[model samples]
Target chain A: MRNCISCQIKAKVEQRNEDLNAKLAFLTMPQPASFSDVVLFADDDDEHPVPVPAHKAVLANRSPVLRAMLDNEMKESLSGTIKIGDVSYDALRAFINYLYTAEVCLDQQLACELLVMSEKFLVQHLKDFCQKFLVSNLNLDNSLSTYTFAHQHNFKPIIDAALTQITASMDKLASQDEYTVLKERDLGLLLEIYEAYFSKQADTTMYI
Target chain B: MRNCISCQIKAKVEQRNEDLNAKLAFLTMPQPASFSDVVLFADDDDEHPVPVPAHKAVLANRSPVLRAMLDNEMKESLSGTIKIGDVSYDALRAFINYLYTAEVCLDQQLACELLVMSEKFLVQHLKDFCQKFLVSNLNLDNSLSTYTFAHQHNFKPIIDAALTQITASMDKLASQDEYTVLKERDLGLLLEIYEAYFSKQADTTMYI
Candidate 1:
């Protein structure tokens, strides 16, 4: 009886060590391919991996605030398409990945996309990023685009922030003759500055 | 014929003014119960509003990087659930709202949420805020929680950063008898510190 008990204990230890090895192997494995068919294998016996509902998965994966915002915007916007710029397809893909894995790779384009999406989703971090990106990349050309996009989206605060950025850039540009001529002819810049300054005045008046 | 033409021009002017008034009304009005709904209705019925697709709307309303991260994680984890903190939810929602409306209210909670969600979504500004928050809130209890969470999530750099924070706090705690006694009894803390320090050493050795 003692010999039988000792043998069982030995077998259990071996099994545990094997399980640990398997787990380590999984952790060390290289990431799979991007495309579904090439990377993941669909179970032959089952239609799906887990029988969890799609909506539940989405809810579980998405932030409650983002889900609410998406629903709200979908309800509110007559046009469903929200225009996003300075954000590429890859960056969008990366953000989605992070939502799932809590992991992400940051880059310039990804940074821009993160900002635009954050603004669209009412994600504060993304908006701050967009603001910072606009502020950091504030220049004659980009600022104009940022200003126009913010206004078009009715992102008044972003518009205001971008406008402030543009105004600051404009101040710097005003010192140069080339920028002055460019600002005069650039209808986008002119409109952005006018809107930004006026909004600021309006905001101050409301507070007063 | 000349009188008729003049009358037609006046009618056109009246229509233009009416259109402008409607736009002004929209701008002046507090956000309608369904702002996106109004926009969607306008886009469908009026020539002025552009058509936006549902999927694109989803994309536009989400942080691109976050969205991408979500997608990637969805593909990779396939069956994993992400546990989000309270702060992350707030930031994500605020950011999403900004994306849709381009306006944000910066409150302490909102800022903290944004920071947490940014780290989750891999948004730079959010990450920066998370770092800033960590730096500002550097203390034994908070750092311990931060370190443990960061480690669990496999946030290498963040874990490293948090470790530095933990060490600094530990240095302070080491002087206190209560902390040492607590540390002896707290298995979770002991395990966490052991694993963190050992893993870090392993990483350093691998690099070497």
Candidate 2:
């Protein structure tokens, strides 16, 4: 196959198989192992030292920068134990997968956990993705968990964005009879968020 | 294995596999057999459509919104026979895959083509990703392409952001050698962006 360098398309030719295999071989030379320790520690026969799936593992393998980051993270953890918020090993693994594959298969709780980890680890891209996801999927009743993440991580941009969205729907949120009951049950945090946002608005207007 | 909704992690599950699968299936389904008698078609068997390889088909199966947009585009093309841009059927397919998968295995030229299509289609997320990729991968000589994308898409936000970054590195970007080369090679567009941004800044200052 003739490969177009500009667009990476493969054109059919009599020597397609030979050309493709050659190109694949060049592209697949293990992409210069990013996590030297991970690579070194794993048995040669073992596919992945960390238990990520094969497809995702291949994606991770191709990204040398991401691999290096993971290696550095592991090294730091082993040497002095760096904390990624309240994330456990599982959450860290999921976050790594999300970074490499942009495919995360985790529960909302784990997603929140990974968002916290993304913040602690200074994974700005991951944090941005998480914030976007939260904003796109916000539900007033269920948003408390996401709000907590926004608050705790000091993801001020995300908090600002979410507040705009939630505040716009304040009447609908208040009208939800079931949610009103739940708010009555746990009014402290709810009141705190309201007061905080209102004060923030007041401060902005005062500045104006 | 149990699915997300029925699994022990039900409460935590943020996304379900079925949701993604359903979306993908919808995207891949063949266009209606008869669109006003034009009869849009695919070459491969309906059961096994053209497999553009996993990596190459970045947006192979995307959200229904994007798929609908593509279908409408195809229908419009068939009806009006107006092809203004360089977008081809294959390019549109690849662009869709890039949207869904967040990765495209196309070459730089094809990627640029897809980026233009994304902008035309109002796929802001894809446009943003493409712009970021182009900027990060750019060199002084090759940076013109990134600038072109910024100009064409009216991606003012990205352009403004890039200008801030580049100007912040004025010592590097505006060195004697670099400044002379850029002035001679890209003077028109450079001045345009400069004037637009400077005017915006002036407006903000006046308001302040």
Candidate 3:
């Protein structure tokens, strides 16, 4: 009887979940069919950048960084051309599309690129999504690089997660070629990794 | 062990649901912050209609009717002025806001008005939302009105649900003031009510 009652509660929650899901579906907007009032350019596209046309309202709503730029009547807003430096055309496209639809097909590389972009734009949702993707995909091979990236982005959850993954595989980490490169590129990061490993070791000893 | 596995599965589903909810929040664009290409007017506010400025992109993405109107280079598209007849300023505002946000706090009257608006514009999500609200709020007092409203809008689910409620309270339905109004204004609706009641009776008898 108790399990049956619990099952009934679960069913009710599931129904509410379905309702929320339908609401989400209804809210996820399709990309504009036309009538765009702003254009974004990924500088990597060179002299004649491929312009991503979008509505200012959408850009402003999605990103506080973009909102400030648009609202302040900045050079980019006035000239009606936003040149985002360092991002590839594809990344910019996916980023803009995500702002419109809140959907992205992420690979490891795309996830990293978008996470960085999401941070720059102050789009926390996309940042969280990218962080989750990277965390899920983290391995001994990628953990150091991910840890560095997460550190660069000022992501606490990601740092803690990556450090946990890195510390767990510290022995194998020393054997990896990338580990040697990381030590050379950023000794600080290597120190932090060792520190996390030591801290975890101390915690284990305390447990014992 | 079985319960453990089920709990793990439920946890995963809930995590996915959270991801989807975050996506929905990100995708819900705030109504246009000044760069509006189209203005909507409630015809009831004829004297000095307070124009609600909105982006063509948002309007087009939300409703096919709006998309067609904007894309086909019609008069409304040409002037950027859409005159929606038969709606109060409040209903029109709420309707447009719902188009942007997929959210509305609905009471019965607003729900009915929005249902009509949603049907007219082919916004199925809003129509379903309003239909759900009306059905959930349905009772002996509002059953005939809801049934009539559903019939006019060709809402099958609401029609069936309202009919069920009405048929179960036939004696009470006849005594209601709105019943007298409906019987006089639309005798056909009364005939449909009797027909539904008889049909239900036959089905009940067959089950017995």
Stronger candidate by lDDT (1 vs 2): 2
Worst 10 residues of 2 chain B by lDDT: B31-40
Arrange candidates by TM-score, highest first: which order? 3, 2, 1
In model 1 chain B, the worst 10-residue window by lDDT is B35-44
Q: Model 2, range A19-119, lDDT digits (tens) per residue?
A: 33332222221222221222222122233434332222232333334334445445632442222333455766666545444456656666677677666
Task: Please report the candidate that would top TM-score against the real structure.
Answer: 3
TM-score versus the correct structure, for each prediction: 0.28, 0.31, 0.91
The candidate scoring highest on lDDT is: 3
Give candidate 3 regions above 4 Å deviation. A1-4, B1-3
Docking class of predicted structure 3: medium
Give candidate 3's error at residue A34 in angstroms: 1.5
lDDT by residue (tens digit), candidate 3, A1-208: 5568778878887887888788777766666528888888998887778889888888889998998898877987898778898899999999998887788899988998898899899999888888888888988778887888788778888898889998887778888777888788888888988887888899999999
lDDT string, candidate 1, A26-67, tens digits: 212122222111111112213343211112112222444434
Q: Model 1, range B1-208, lDDT digits (tens) per residue?
A: 5568757765675564554333222212122222221111111123343322112122222344434533644531333222233433344445444333323556444544555555555454345545555556545655555555555555566566767666544446455554466477666755666576667678889999
Off by over 4 Å in 2: A1-36, A39-85, A105-107, A171-208, B1-208
